[model samples]
Target: MSNITWSFADRVVAITGSAIGMGEGAVETFAAAGASVYGLDVDAKRGRAVAERTGSTFVECDVTSSAAVLAAFEQIATRHQRLDVLINNAGGFWEQNTTESISEIEWDHVIDLNLKGVFLCARHAIPLLRQSSAGRIITISSLAGQTAIYQSSPAYAAAKAGVLSLTRVLASELGADGITSNAIAPSAVLTERIKVVRSAEERAATAASIPLGRYGGVDDLVTWMMFLASEEGGYMTGETIAVNGGRFMS
Candidate 1:
């Protein structure tokens, strides 16, 4: 993907939301890098297929459920005593509603998936991470969380913002154990879900708005993830990297 090369040999990596999009890409990337990879998702069929194609293990897990998350980690612990990296990559919102227009169910689903899921995974992953010399928690946040350039789901935005906060707290709490926690906030990555949500005209308009003059590819984000999970990224923690192609610069 990027010019930078990484070697994850002997590393044990676990990825959430591995059925599609960024999570799927992370599974493939890490596995190719020689890491023992495990892909977790609610979509058992697609998840199993991805694992088979990439030579990684697959675990059917609903991240929103504590019991499911615990069982998934238990399986990982049984297979590998420690975890090197945990990629929290499962989150999405179907509805783009205003604060008042959003329903309770919609809000809870978005918040639970985007925010609560991160918390649960981090909570469970900490023990395994502590067992590793260089443990990492790399979360996939969103540009919408930082700011709303367009109309978007209120719950999704709020939940993503919450992820940023949680990432920092995890970093602070786990830094003593030599574990680093960080996040990536990406914008306008043209995944299958994005393509379905935005029409051609809307996509073009978004591209024109970005200084980069195009939507981001999966590689762009995956490459950042690689860096965050590498030895070179060991010193950095409690920070969020914004990879939005100059769309929102702070």
Candidate 2:
């Protein structure tokens, strides 16, 4: 991602789950545009390496813990003294279980990571975000949040649904403060995780099922994310933009 100097020069961004996958894509995208990013993830070494490549700072954050989230944001604020954007991109599939058999422990774990994680980060980031001239919050969600469930557990779907709802509520609450909150709900994206987890035949089958006859790439969502984080996207708020390659039209 070659940078455009005019787009994101000197912007302050904090993104979670940035050690890999779509989160990594965002880190690179923002950095390419000249933003100084605070990349947060569980993998300290990999996160730092990625940040080094982009001239970003690395923060080890367990998004589910409020204390960790607070500390991480405080550290970012201390260094940059401002936060212009935040992407709550943590959370993913937990265990394979339906409502009938999903244990309470598993449910709580996923919810805390997915929904509570976003809440905690946003709850703490508000003050710093408000200090910026253009504050933006983009939460990474999924089609599961708006549609029926599938490969993911019920807890994942429910938590993402909560994120979608929270997007709307936060937009309403913070629009007056010059902050915008939005979500990206994606489907079958192509990543190392997906390639390693699914066999070729299974992956091909899923791709064929999509209307585009292919799985989504990280670049697909990165484009939309850039828009949401850009001045052009200033008018967009409380939007749950679906980037599923027409797999599920919403």
Error of 2 at 223 (Å): 1.0
Provide the global lDDT of candidate 1 against the true structure.
0.92
TM-score of each model, in listed order: 0.98, 0.96
lDDT of 1 by residue, 1-250 (tens): 3444699999999999999988998888899899999998999999999999999999999999999999999998998989999999999897889988999999999999999999999999999999998999999999988998556899999999999999999999999999999999998898888888799999999999999999988889999999999988999998999999898987
In terms of lDDT, model 2 sits at 0.89
Please write out the lDDT profile of model 2 over residues 1-250, one tens digit for every residue: 5233347888999999998888888899898888988988988988988998878889999999988999999998888888999999987874667899899999999999999999999999999989999999999999888888567789999998999999999999999999999999998888778888889998998899899899998888887888888777888899999999788886
lDDT of 2 at 110: 93
| Structure candidate 1, residue pairs in collision | none
